[model samples]
Structures are given as C-alpha cells and as structure tokens.
Target: MRMAQTPAAADGSSGDGALGRVPPQSIEAEACVLGSMILDAMAIDQVVQILHDDYFYRPAHQIIFRCLVQMRHESKAIDLVTIKEDLVRRDLLEKIGGQDYLVALAEGVPTSANAEYYAQIVRDKALLRQLISVGTQIVRDAYETQDEAPIVVDHAEQSIFEIAEQHIGDSVITLQDLLRHTFEMLEQHEGQLITGLASGYTQLDELTSGFQKGEMIVLAARPSMGKTSLLLNIAENMAVIDQAPVAIFSLEMSRNQLAERFLASHARFNLRQMRRGVITPETWTALQTAAGTLETAPIFIDDSASLTVIQLMARARRLKSLHDIQCVLVDYMQLMLYSGRATSRQEQITEISRGIKALAHDLEIPVIVAAQLNRGPADRPTHTPRMSDLRESGSIEQDADVVMLLHNEDYYHLGEEGYQPRGVTDLIVAKQRNGPTGSVPLVFLKDYTKFESATFGVEQPLGEPMADAPF
Candidate 1:
C-alpha cells in the first residue's frame, strides 16, 4: 500500500482538510500523513507568490501559511491574532475575540502556539504544501553555509519585464503584469533618467533628478573657484534637505578646515573673523545651529591626508553597508593614490579611477570624484577646461559615466564688476552619456561652500540645452 507517514507528517494534514491543522499535540507529536509540505524552505516572496491564487484557502486557511512565511522571513515566531485578523478579513474564520479585541490579542501571540499553528496548517494542506516543506530544507542548508547577506545576481540582460517563475513551471504574471512592470521598471530607474541627485535646486532637480547611482560624477574647478564650497552645497542638498547619505573624501583639507569653510559660507561671516577669533553672538548662534543640523546629517567626511584607493573602497563599502551612503564626494582626484600596488603616477591614477568606478557599481551609488584641470587650460586665453584638460582625463573620462567641469568666469577675471559674481560658481555639465550633453548653470556660494540652483528664463528638459553656455 502507500508508504507510512511519520508523526512529523501530521505537520502537513489537519482534520483531512479542516481549518488549519490545529496545532499538533506538540513538536514531538507529529501527524502520520504520507505527504507533508514543509514550506520552511521557500523565499518569503516565493511563498507569497505560491499562494497568490490558492484555490483552497479562504482567508483563514491563508493564515497558517502566512505565519510560516513570516516566521521564516523574520526568523521569529508569528503572532496569532495578526494571523487571525488576516483570516477574518477574508471571511474565513469568525472574528477571533471580535474585531475590537482582535488587534490586542494579535499583539500578544505566544511562540509555541504560533509555531504549532503554522506547522499544523501545513499538515491540513499537505498535498498543496509539499513543495514549501521541500523548499524549507533547501533554504536551511543555504543559510547555514552563508553568514553574509545573500548576493542576488540578476543575469537577465534586460531589466524590464523580468519574469519570475516557480518550481512547478507555472508563470505567475501575464501580459498585464508585463505592461505594469514596464512603467514600474522606469519608476525604479528614476535617478538614472535624471542628473544630480540633490533636490535643493528646483530647476536642477527638474533637469536631472540627481546624479544617477552607479556613476562617477566629477566636479572639477581650479584652486579657489569654490570647489569645496560647491561640494559642501551638494552635501547639504543631498544629506540635509533630501535626507540622502553623502560621503566626502577630503584629501587636501582637514576636517576642521572643511567645517570652518562651510560655516563661513552659511554664516556669512568674514573668513578672517570666523577663523582668527572674535565671534559675535549671532554668528556663534548660527555656527551652533549649523553644527547641530550637521550633527545628525548623514554626511560622512574622511579628511585623511593620505587616503589610498583600496582604503577608500574599503571605507565606501563599510559606509554603503552600514551608513547607507547613497552618494560619494571625492574632494579631488589627483591626490588619491593606490596602496595595494606599485606603479607610476598615471598608472596609480588609472587604477584609482577603475577602483572608484567599481566602488560605485558595487555599492550602486553615485560617486562625485572632483579633479584638477591641467596647465593646458590655465595656458588657454579664456581658461575654459576641455575634457582633455582634466588632470588625468584619459583614465578619469574613461571610467566616468558623467564628466562635469566647473567653470566660474568671475574667479578667472577679477576686474569685471557687473558680470563678476561675488557668490556664484557656474557648474558646467561637460559630458553626459545617457542624454544630451550641455552646461547647467548652477550658483556657487564661495562663502557657504555650497551650490544652489539658479532659475533662468526657460527651464529646458533633460535632453535640451540651455541658452547661456558659459563653459
């Protein structure tokens, strides 16, 4: 006849298809049903998908399976009341303890009952759940082997409409899902379709949502052209206002110097007064408030004078995993060197660029690596830097998805009064791979070490060009 079912098989059958197999007598006492579904081995999403069109479950029957899924996902015991209410919502079982007491009771689920209830339900739905139990065993084995977070690799060349099929050879979604998923796919890629990540500049945000994640965005300028200030502005925009974590890798300046400069910019205090001493109450209050705001801001600063490429990658990974860093701000590129290998300056920089790009892709975050333009630009009459003018343009441009060269006319020419902007640095978006390449005029505050969006007569869409092409 049929093979004899073990006591554990009781985990798969309840009353020969009654309400979830009522919690078994105990973990030791299992049912003798021939085939039981363990469900313990499935992905939470897979479990949900498996039960999407369950012909047998009336909301109540869904509870036990759901409880099992939750337990596996959380690695914790399930709450009975929550499960009960979910059942009640489907008109499966009479509202446990009425709808009023339902929530409170759900909040107080005992572990033994939760585990047993889920297991017992599996017993009742044995035939329908065999795969789940098998999956559970597989998952247990995998988890035992890997202590780190599981890396899920999507080999599908096309990101859109990627279908997920179950073990039984049944596709869960159809043509409708494909269409909806296309729109949703675009929604997921919002940052990639736009430029700069900060939301502070309304127009800039409109032009480019922010810098795309997994990209190397260079912000380059000469010695005193508000490069650091522009950096602080972006940090403030992303980390402060938009609430995105931004990392700053400062090689040239100390932590204190960067802070002092940022404070001077927002506080509007003379750099000499703020630095040399003589702090007024208003200025002190402003400094204190700025400090307080920055205290909780997700702006990570590494003012390491001798930061190596490998060390930077290590730090960036640590930040991406722990601090949830979304964007990177490297003060200047030339200052960075490779620590792991020995090579010439060009080789070192080449390795550094490769490492930075890899870091961005690995972390799936935008990396803003600023750089220094060569003397070629300085030697030019107008002093506008070309892509070749970048200190190490070959490696930098090759690795970068977007290369931006910041140019401020006022910084180069001091004499012109009206055109000479005291508080503006125009950000030149010299190159863009995904869309049209053009200059975006961004205001640079020399004092605050920040960049702000300057609204113009017309707001051009991302693919269009602006009229004032200063760069």
Candidate 2:
C-alpha cells in the first residue's frame, strides 16, 4: 500500500510490478548509520556530512537521526543515557520508541568505522527518491502548465541541472584549507604575464589583468560612440586570436552585419567599399584569407533582436555546457526584455542587470555587457561620461565589477574651427571593484570600424569616404 503512493509509482508506464514494489530504500543502512553514530561520538561528524534526517525512510529512524544531530550541535555526549534524556526533554522519547530502541540500534551495528559507508547508502537512496519526485513533477508540469514550450523546456533543464549540482555540496573551508588553496593558485600563476584571459589591448590588459572569470563588466557610451566596435574587437581578440569560445547575443545588429564588420576589421579592408561590392583584388584576397581563419574560430553569434533576460540565460547556459564558452557579450542592455512583473522601466533594468550579474557568477565566466548613457555627459561642461550616467537604473553600476565609459572628444567637435578627427577615444575606467580606475586612450579606425591601442599625440590618417558610406 505504501509503495502504491510513492512518487516513482505514479508513472503508469512502469508496469504493475514496479508500482507494487517498494520505493528505493534500505532500512538496514539507516539503522547501521544511526547505530554507528551512537557507538562512537566522533563518527557522527562524518555521517552528518553525508546523511540528513530525510535520508532515513522510516519515521522513527528520521526522528532519532534528527534528535542525535541536535544533541551533537549542543555539545552533548552521544551515549544512550544522554540521548534518552534529551529526547524526553523535547517530548520525542516515546515517539522514537524510547531508550530500548536506542540500545537496539547501538547493538545492531558491528563497528563505527563503517559509518561513512552506511551513510553513503542512505544518501544514494534519498537521491533516488528525489529523482522520482522531480520526474513526476516534470511530467505533471508538461501536461498542465500554460507556458510556452520553450519556457517549459527551460524549466525542466534548470531542474535537472540543479540535481546535477548536488554533488558539488558546500564550499565552506577552514583558514588552513583556504591558505593551502591560495598558495597552490599562486604557484600555478607564477611567472605568468596575466592571470586571466587577455583582451589583446596592451594598456587595457595592464589595467585589468585581463577580464577575470565570474565578473560582470559594463561598457557604457552614448549613441554612435564606438561601444559596439570596441566590444567586437575584444570578442575577435579572444575568439580568433586566443582560440577561446565566445557567445555573442546581439539585440541591435544582425549576424550578417556583424560578420561584415569582423571581416573588414580583421582583413584591413574598407568597409564602405565592401558594402558597395567594390572590393579590389588585394582586398578580396586578404578577406578570403581572413574568412578562412575566422571560419574555424569558436565564436557563436545569436542575432535574436527580441531577447528576454530569462531566455538569454537559458541560451548562455546551453552554450557554456555544450561548447565550454569562456566569455559572453550582450550588445547593449536597454534593448533586452524583462518578462517579469516590473512596476517601472527602472525596476526592469534593475532585474536585467542583476540577471546578467547572476549569469556571470553562475557560469564562472566574464560577461561583457554594453550599456547606453543618458544626456548627463552631453549637458556637462566637460562632456565626460560618469558611472552615474548609466541609463534606466543605478543597479547597473551597482552590479558591475568593472565600468568602462567611452568618450570621443572628436565626436563633439566634428566640424569646429581647427578641430581635427584624430580618431582618439578615451576609455574611462570609472569604476573598478578590484583595481585602480583611469582612462585609456584608443584609436578608432572609422574606415574599418576597428579600435586599437593609440600612441599619444599620433593621428591616424582618415581618407575620403565613399559617396554612399553608411556612416
């Protein structure tokens, strides 16, 4: 009768035999584990780490196990007399069959040395029961939920992922353990130029030891400030040069447009001419060679124009598991959709920012997110972008590990008297949680839509543009 009510028995396809059989459990293993803990107080520590109260199948065993754990927490001895007294004080003595039951458990086990082994069996059985419950829930949700198919699938995947992560357990450690781990990491990074993935920019790499894992990096700028160009350059450097897998979620541009920019930037071809189908022979050959190299680079681009934060996280999780992607890029945050019940745009932005930060921490990878600034920079006397200028909400700045604001003075003085288009852009490191903040100058090659480290006082030549130049 008990077996018929078990979660595993709910599946009619499992046949009558499975429904009639008992749920996966071992009462003897539970008895042995409790007996071992009672016989030797020192053995309780090992058993507690593996088995919890719910791990015991029988109600009496569960109550006894929980009581023993409570006694251990109170620094009380685990002998029979103390166990009975504590149980009596809590009105649970008769409920768990009194002192005779405790004596029987202690006498049932041969030795306390096998406590861990007994605990493992109990844990395994508990895990099987959990799997049965999760599977039953998944089936129920599939048949009854009103959500779309993709949302349902995402929920199921997340549920299974949670179960898979159970083996990882808690990360708490003693100071001695922490010191040993730190020293090991230091030794592994000894004589290394950078401790994280290199961004391929000389000074930027120096300012940040390259983008560290599990960090949310925000790049903010006004419209047409070359934020997207700089993001692509960094992605190209990591994916093409370093052979690292990168996932790019572009809500603003199509994949074809992105590919064209990558080709022009990498091959040094004129983007305007390429768009006009007027590529010269030399440029054609260079583009072909660049395409051959880029064809093999592990860069995955998703040009979904309308992406919710939940969908983005689900796709990122898939890419990280399938391809071991080292980094992720979202081109501009204001365009992302939030399906949750947000009262205002600011609340929506806050949730989106937190979601991106959570993704970085969960995947243990650096996530570079492009953001748009407000009119604060343009209205100011200095025309400089600040962390406070981040649009929609303050949560973006709060959540980011690094905040880079792009400013090109040339944009403000395009046709002024004696004004020159020096192609110089200032990447202001306004907020860095772990390092000093400063501005790094870069040269933005408008012709190829590329950016590189700039030499001070050096001006890049700007040739005349084509009649139909997109810019």
Candidate 3:
C-alpha cells in the first residue's frame, strides 16, 4: 500500500500558535470517504450523490474520485485495477500516487456501511468553506463603498441564500424511493379525508383533492367578476373552517377593506349598509358574532400597495417562519411591482410568475394568486375567459399548477333575453395539471361581496338596503 501524505495544519502556523486560517475542512473525513468508496465498488453509488470532486480536501483524492465517478457513469467496474488503468490512460495515475495509493484507500476503510456518513461530513465541511468564502466577499463589498448599502445587502443575502440552497445537498430521489413515499402517502390518506390542504368547498375539494403542497394556483377574471371575493371566500374557508394559518398579500385592497368584506360575508349583512352604519338589530348581532369568529381565525393580511415580488417573498418567508402559514394568497398579481432588472413588461410578469412558483416550491406550501384577464373576453361572443387571456404574459398560465377563470354570465347578458343569471358565477377550471378541468358553479352575493356554493338557491337576504355597494 502507498503511504498517505499528512496534510498541513488548517491554521496558518508552523509548530507554534496561529491566528488566521484558510477555512474549515475535515481531511480525515475526506480520506475516509475515499477509502470507503475504494473498499466496496458499490459504495461509490451511495456516496456519489453526497460528495463531488471539489468536496475532497486532497488533490490526489479529488482526482481519484473524479476517475471513479467517470468509471461508474460509463458502467465500468470501479476496483483499484480499473481505476488505475483509466487514470494511467489519462496520464493522471502518477499524479494521484499511482496504484499503491488506491490499494491503501481500499485497505484503510473498516466497512463500507459508513460511506454515506463520511461523505456527509466531507460535504458539511465543504459547505462551511463555501460560507466562509461568501462571507469574505460580502465583507469586501461592504468596505468597497461603490454600491448602495441596500444593494450590497441584497447581494449578500442572495449569495448566502444560494450557498444555503447548494448545501441543502442532493435532492434527487430514485424511482424506488419515490414509489415508497407515494405508497406511504396513499396509506396515510386511505380514509375519507382529502390528501391535500382542504379548500373547504366540497365540490372543489372533490375536484382537486384539495390544493396540494408546492402548487401554484392562478385565479383569473375580468373586472367585476368577483375573483377577489372568491379568493377571500377560500381564504376564509381555509382559515376559519379548517383552522389553517393563511397569509394574504392584498396588493389591490387595504387591510380594512378586506376585513370589512370578510365581516360582511361572514355576518350575511349588506356591506353597503354596514359601511353606511344602517344595519338592523339582528344584523348587528350577526356582525358581532362574525367579528368574534374572525378575530380568532388564523388569518394574516398584508396590504402593501406597491409590493415587489422580492419583498413579497421575504414577507412570505417571515410569515412561514413566525406563524407557520399553511397557505399564501396574493390578490391580483398584475398590481404587484417587479423589482428585478427585467426589461419589458412581459419579462417582468414572467419573473414575478416564476418567483412565486419558486417560493411555493421552496416553502412547500400552496400559493393561490389572483390575476386579471385581458379584453379578449369582452370581444368574444360568450365572453368566457381562457388561459391565453391572462394579462401581460402567458408565463402565469404556464407556471401555474391550476388555472381557474371566473366568468359571470350576468355581466355579459345583463339586459338580453334569458340573461343575467342572478347570483350565479361559473368558476371555469380551464387548466389543471393533475386533475380534470371543468366549471364549478358558485353564487356571487354582490351585496355581501362574497361567494358561496351554487347549491344554495338564489335567495336575496332579508332587509336588503337599496343602495349602491362599493367593492
């Protein structure tokens, strides 16, 4: 067996004391990982996902590992003889201490079972070294004084986030592993319960099996089609009925306005009458009860008027960390500002769409975003919106796991014959990545600014005020 070379001390000192060092590393862990891979040919399969060539502290180990990985990729045997022959073919065998070192590595490991554990140690130390590099760059940027503080800070945060993501390690799952997880999920969901977070609407829940985690749902509609109202209704259902913590980013409405709509919806009172302070005694009692219910619901609202997608992600992360929010709702994506350096409006919208999808994936939560449709529906005869009519860009439709279009037949045929289906709204599920697409009927209560199941007959509320409602 070849003799192993001892690495210099990490701290920059001779035999005496030292102060500054390069970065944190574990040479022993790197050697153990290499030794394990050399001991058992199949051990490379277990550690290959965790350790890359750069993870090795020793250059010879890095070269040896690279050769092993290439051999494995090519479906070749990974014993010391094959590895040495391949390295010799590339004139790297002598550079990496020849066949004797390979023999030494194979003989050093006690067992191949701890290969993954040793690889993890190497990976963690490599991550620390990367973090130190990022920190050093950040400090240098801080002292340069060329850029604005906020810009520097943003750059630093982004760099750190990228490092953290890299250190999250191999997320690739074999089909066998994935199937095992799927079987577990199926067994756990063997009962009558929905597999995902319940939307609280029986028909929609049945259609979607509830909104699955890491999904992006796009709800689109033209003006006055009650998309926001529908979003609020779902949020209400999830938060109040399911007791799931929800965070709402209302770019188009204020907190008070959203709260007022929620109160009106919950209390079954006319929003206009409540706003004008003309509610009856029974309405007052209902409003009091509704307020009490909503006061206890785990619903959080952020009504930032000029929120950018970056700011929204930061806020969503904070909400997730602090409140453990189960779902996120962004009211009207078109109103949100795109803080990225995209040139065109379409590019900006694309960035925003992609950002929200990434956020949902990163947080492993379902994100429901309300969007606006263009004037294509107005020109059409039936006036039903399609996925192509999504405003600004088509990326929103492409990024969404489910795309729903709200169409109010009443808006298009208000004065014609057999027109204006009172309180009836058609929620067209135009695109569903994992389910069937169809229309789910809903009742739009204009006075209360809410939506309910269409099975509830169109019965106007008692003591309806004859005034214009502001929504």
Candidate 4:
C-alpha cells in the first residue's frame, strides 16, 4: 500500500513562526504539484480535461494562483507584497523581498482560477460516493426486511391543471380557457388577495410588475448612482402610502442616517440640516409629521456592517414569519458575505447570488440587490451602462432573472453640460432573462437619497426637491 505524505511542522524558514509540522518532502511535493498545475492550468479546457478532479481545493497551490487568476481579467501586478500578505495569513510564506524580488515574482506567467471550479467537481464526486454507499445499504436492508411494494412517490409529473383534472382526462377544458377564466376571476377581485406591486414608476411598472414575489434583484451601479435612494423611495411608497411590510439591510450607512434620509426625503427638509440637528421650527413640523408617519409605517432596518448572506437569510426568514416580508431589497450585492466559503470574489458573489435567488423562491417574494459596476463604465463617452459594466458579471448576470443598472446623467455631467437633465435617472435594463433589454427613465432626488416616478419629483424646486414626498 502506498503511504500518505503529510507535511511536517515548519522549522522557521522565513521566521513567520513554527509551522504545523508538515513534512518537508510533502511540502516540496505540493510545490511541485502547484508548479505543474500552474503551468498546466494555462488553457481552461486543457486543465479541466487533465485534472479529472470533479472537485478539489489546492490550499497549498491557491496561495500562488489566486493572484494570477485575477490578472486574466485585467493586467494587475501580483507582487511579493500580496504574496507575503497571503503567506502571512496562512503562516506559509515569509517576507524576504525588495522591488527586485517583487518584479521577478510578478513576471511569472499568469493563470486562471479554475481551482475553485475543480474543487466543486471533487465535492460533487465525494457526495456522489457517499450517496451511493448509503443508498446501496438502504436497498440491501429493505430487501432483507422484505418490505411491501415500493413506496409510491409521484412517478408522474403534472401541472396544477393536469392534477386537478386527472380523473376526467380527455374531456378537460383547454389550458387557454382555464387561464382566461382565472384571469377573469382575478380581475373581479382586483386589489384583494393578490396585488401585483407597482414600482410607482410608470415606465418601470410597465416593464416589470414592481419586482414580483420571491425575486432577488441585483440593483447595481457605480458610486453615487443612488441605489439606496431608489430603495428608500420604493420602501417609503410601500410602507407609508401602500402600507406593506418592508425591511432594509444597510451595511455601509447607519440606521439613524437612513431614518434621517427618510425624514429628509419625506419632509423635504435639507438632508444636511436634519442630519446635523439644524431643523428650523417650520421644518420641525414637517419632521414631526414624518415621525408620525414612520411610527405608523411597517419599515424594518438592520444597518450592521459586514453581514454575510447566511446571516441575512436567517434574519430575513425570521422577519418574514413575523412581519410577512413580501419583498426584499439588498442595498448592494458585493457588500454581502459568503460566510464559510473559501473561494474567489467571483465565486463568492455567485454563491451569494444563488442564496438570494433561493431566498426569493423559498419565501415567495421578490428581492432586489444593488451592485457595484466596474470602472470600465466611467471611461465611456456615452452615459449608458451595459452588462459588461457589472463589477463581477459572471454569475450575477447569469443568476439574476432581471438585471437593472441605475445611472444619473446629472450626477455624471457635474452640471458642465449645456443642457442639464433635472430629476433624470436612467434605468438601464441591461439584461432581462424573462423580458426585453432597454432603458427606462426614473427620478432622482439626490439630497434625500431617494428616487421617485419621473414626474413625481418634477414640481420640487432644485434646492427643495422631494418637498412633496409620497409618504
């Protein structure tokens, strides 16, 4: 039998500290494997074919490869500093370098991050083996016990209508007729039981029924695009005017800051004035009215920074059971955490996207998430954004049923342009797996950090925008 090789405890190679006593030979072997993998991992298809590892994690190799993987997308220098940081974190590498060493290390051929992908395959294989073993044992036990006829599970998959009329078979009503009848019934009971939430933005609602139930939406944009404002606007309309339960998970902003923004928007008080306790008597009356409105509204918020996706899900589920969360909006996707995952930012984001999607499906509500756009968008002469502009476009675009990018020309132009488009916000529907892709206009109330219907904030003077907050 071949003996397993384990790394010996470190003997202070670079003086980070004592290692875990991994054998020196094992460490050498790992370095060799990593070197070969680094070279072989050139073409993704070749690497996939050669590795044959359904899933795998090369903690030893990833120490070097993660940097290279990031470089494939852009020309980023992976110097000794970054390597030292990784090694320091793991106590695997020591910083014994100057610029010359950094330059030498940085010159190594770049590779891809196929490691995590392969690791997933290995995991699946391991799970398959376990499942087969368990399943085989179950079958053997069932046979020995001489169980009755196999438990009847639904060998037949059927739609709601099919199941409803199974016994009546051939003489069933056509699906179209049934659908028409159902629509008629729904129309008869309009505004009762089932209400397709409208975004309050006319064009947006025309395109999407205000982000339907159990939906996880990634509402991404570059800095200063007002993703928070849009959500606050929607939440305001929902909680105060429409009177629906809403929750806000704010990672960067404080709870008080958010409430202040709400007050600023709802009462048309200057955002700075309210934030710094500078409200005058007249504005205080508006603030009091806004306070009363907040007291009676169904808005919940959690502004804890660095919250993971799992934590968010658990909290969201609890909130749903308690307050009936009909819709969920994540301020931005990139801010979320993957918790126990040991993968690249892209993979972590993919996991988060899947989690949010699951949360929507399981909870039977719509979720909207804001995301950061890549720097590429800023370089374009045109103000329009696209799918490629998404920060980590890989699984985010793939998993999202609808992807909306928010932009304000006014924010971009800085008022230098001859014609300033006031209260103009762009809803660039870069991708819609279930619908069309295009642009829609929205209203931006910059100070209030809120977005309203295009005409909703039109009457407000520039300095006093959001004076007639819907709530």
Top candidate, metric TM-score: 2
lDDT of candidate model 4 versus the reference: 0.60
Task: Look at candidate 2 and tell me the lDDT of residue 118.
Answer: 88
lDDT of 2 at 55: 74
Candidate 1 lDDT tens digits, 1-471: 122222322223334322344422222212111002122233334334333323223232234344445555665533444445455666633422233333332332332223334433433453334444444444555566443222111111111111211233244778998999778867875655544475466555544556777988777777777676777777777777778998899998998887787666656666677777878788888888877877777878899988877677777766776788989889888998556444677777888889889878877788988788877667888877667777754778777777777777666667765664534445566666664555566776444455667655344333443232222
Which has the higher lDDT value, candidate number 1 or candidate number 3?
3
Q: Pick the lDDT winner.
A: 2
lDDT of 2 by residue, 254-276 (tens): 99999999999998888999999
TM-score of 4: 0.57
Q: Rank the candidates by TM-score, best first.
A: 2, 3, 1, 4
How well does model 1 score by local distance difference test? 0.59
Per-residue lDDT of model 4, residues 1-471, tens digit only: 121222233222322211342212222332333333434435332333323222223333343444334442354444446545544565655322223332333333233344334433443433444444444455555566543322111111112212222231133479999999989967964655334565656566656646677666677788888887887777787788778888888887889888888888887677976667887788788889988988898999988788877777777777887898777777767887666444788878888888888877767787877888898668888765666677864777777777778877677677584965566787766665555455676766666666766654422112321222111
| lDDT scores of the candidates, listed in order | 0.59, 0.83, 0.81, 0.60
What TM-score, computed on C-alpha atoms, does each candidate reach? 0.58, 0.81, 0.78, 0.57
